[model samples]
Target: MRLMLVEDDDHVAAALTAVLSRHGFAVTHCRSGAEALQAMLPDDRAPFDVVLLDLGLPDTDGFEVCGRIRKVSTTPVIMVTARSDVRSRIHGLNLGADDYVVKPYDTGELLARIHAVARRTTPGTPDPADPVPGSDVLRLGAVTVELTTRQVNVGGAAVPLTRKEFDLLALLAGRPGVVFRREQIISEVWRTSWEGTGRTLEVHVASLRAKLRTPALIETVRGVGYRLVPPAAA
Candidate 1:
């Protein structure tokens, strides 16, 4: 796998880079969010399969940086945070992060998460759309999500959603404000393991929030999971 690591800590970056490279992965190290952004652009020279990002960057909040990155790329991102709080994990996931690892984490565990994400996103594995809106357009908040073409619109502006992100949105919007459990969403959105892809739930929710004009509509039910509460009804 090709990995882009955005970390300001020189020792951690170097040690992790060497470890991943030794395991036959291409590693690109960036010291700040700006460097990471430049590497992700079309002219970044190297193609990255995934990103290992540190949340405590000197330049910007990692979550804010992730929100910006999700506007264009679907290359999976795994957040590296110092805190192990659930809210922080949820926030990272909500900001389009694929997975997360707290500081002093085991290298093997990080590699395992990367492999799991990589496996699910294998190239040419056809993405399946939502069963309900597979042929129709969906309206949620200010966004018009086209199922047939996989496009979204908010505030008269075009929005882009990845295949998985769109499917998740369609499922949640099917019953607006109905609190769908984490496992239930996994079954509906992805016909895969609940635990293996639970993090995907957070990623798609984050992506949808960023795309939708009224982000507050996607309500987090605290200990439960996510719910789609349309603004007009809220």
Candidate 2:
């Protein structure tokens, strides 16, 4: 995966770039907000898979950079900073950060989060529950999920879904009326055993419901997990 590392500190950026490079990620190191923006221009033919942003920068605040990037690209942004306050985390997320990682985080966890976000944002990668060759489409009521093309439509109109959202929907849609455990969804979709991922799952589910405008399409089985309710059943 190609990753943009926006950190003003040379030593820190170098260390992270090396680590991520060893993990098979092509890292583009930027020392300031301006440099990061410049690298993200349309002229820069190489597209980035994810962005690792630091709150401290020489030219402008990281939040401002994040907001600006959101205006131009839907590339997932993960804020890597020392600001551990809840407000800071909330504010970063509000500014379009997909995930916030505090400084002094475990390297393993960081790698996991990187893979997690990339899985949700990269559509080219095949989904685990890849549909059969001839049966690449699943329809649940007004919702239609084209597995091969990674397209979702509702009521004959297209519905945009984040990578994670599509994975979750596809997983459940594969087995309509069967409740998938929360842990199973996290492991399958997020590719993590981290329990904290449960909250992220809930957030994705809520967002999916709002976007699809078919809340009844995904039925939540309290204490268990969720299932797709076919239109006939609904």
Candidate 3:
């Protein structure tokens, strides 16, 4: 598979090139963010299956690079970074990145992640409970959801959502206009390890409305959690 390798360091790039090449992948390595952007938008460069992006770049930060790419592309991205913070990884994931790998990683694990990330790029398989024409997949106007893959698309364009965002949408979309209490959603969707406040659910809901391109679908019941119906696309 053709993969875009965007990293600023020479040694890391070289090592990745050799390792990835040995795995039968055609790697197009770019050192600078400018070069990476240019390569992605090249008139002749066909879309690569996946991007292995480093967070640190000489020309520009990879986070900004990723944000720019999301404005036009849905090609899967697996971010490679030296930052060990979970929040940083979560931020990248929120910006539409499919996965995150830290520095000093294993080549085999990276390749495995790439392969797993590839399978998720296209999710059409049906689950037992979904309705026909993707009823098993959730449908709310412009939003078409793949419950199995946890991917959400608005107006046929994929939306960059974190795992929690996807879960919140799935729960609400399952029952249109059902007012779930914040605690209920937290208990049901999050199960355990919910470190944020009741307001955190609101934060996620607010974020969903902002990114969803529609504010009417998820309605607030005043002291209730949230509800979902077909998005008012018009």
Candidate 4:
């Protein structure tokens, strides 16, 4: 993958670039926010796959740069910085960052995150195993999932759902009795392998049960994962 590293510190950038290059990534080191932005412009070269941004840029704040980049391109941006406060994380996500990694992160985890963001952003053919393929709809007892339309309804009534919530439900509902490992769900849904994603996955599952008004619909296997128990009619 083609990656852009935006950091003002030469040593830090050099270290990261070397690591990324060794992993088969074409790394472009940008010393300032302006330089990063200029490189992102439409050019003869193929566009970058992902960007690793540092908040302590020489010319501009990384958050501002992220916002500006969003206005110009759809390339995924992952904020790699020393800011670890809750507010900073929220603010970076609010500015359209695909992921946030605090300093002192494991290189292996960073590589996984980079691949996740790139895969999520890139357009590709639909999985052949996806349940809702032709008509783009799947029905489980009283619950209904419309994949193409991105809608969900329960017993003829519409149930509002965020994007991730719907995705979680659809994944489980596709194979009612099969248990889905937490890691598999996260990788397929969030497209990331970060250990911290487990909490987010749990929250989404709880929200799905509540919204569907079926607490027993999704059963949690002890020390395993989760599975959808199809209703009687289904």
Every model's TM-score: 0.52, 0.55, 0.52, 0.54
Model 1 worst lDDT window (10 residues): 124-133
In model 1, what are the clashing residue pairs, if there are any? none
lDDT of 1 by residue, 1-234 (tens): 578999999998898887676444788899999889988889736567888889899988888878888898988898987979999999999988888889889665576577667657656321222234244766765677676677778877987778778778777665565565576567657876477786778887887787675778788878656777766876
| Models sorted by TM-score, best on top | 2, 4, 1, 3
lDDT of 2 by residue, 1-234 (tens): 679999999999898887676555789999999999999998746689899999999889999999999999989899999999999999999999999999988765676687778778777643334443357898887888999899999899999899999999988887666566676678788878746787898999999999999889888878757877878988
Q: Looking at candidate 4, what is the lDDT of residue 159? A: 94
Q: Best candidate, TM-score-wise? A: 2
Candidate 4 residue 106 C-alpha distance from true site, Å:
0.3
> Per-residue CA lDDT of candidate 4, range 1-234, in tens?
578999999998898887676555789999999999999999999898889999999788999999999999989999999999999999999999999999999776687688778768866423312564465788888888888788999999999999899888888877666666676678778988738998998899999989999889998877657888878723
| C-alpha lDDT of residue 109 in model 3 | 60
Candidate 3 weakest lDDT stretch, 10 residues:
125-134
Error of 1 at 17 (Å): 0.8
TM-score of 4: 0.54
**In each prediction, how many residue pairs overlap at the backbone (N, C-alpha, C within less than 3 A)?**
0, 1, 3, 0
Consecutive 10-residue window with the lowest summed lDDT within model 4 = 124-133
| lDDT of the structure predicted as candidate 1 | 0.75
- The true-structure Cα RMSD of candidate 4 reads 12.0
lDDT of 2 at 109: 67
Q: Model 3, range 1-234, lDDT digits (tens) per residue?
A: 679999888888898887676444689999988888888885766678789999889878899889888777877888999997989999999998999999888664676577678767845422211234435687788888888778889999999899888888887776555455565577656774335667778888999999998888888867434667555532
Greater TM-score among 2 and 3 belongs to 2
Q: How many backbone clashes does candidate 3 have?
A: 3
Full-model lDDT for every candidate: 0.75, 0.84, 0.76, 0.84
Point out where model 3 deviates above 4 Å: 122-234
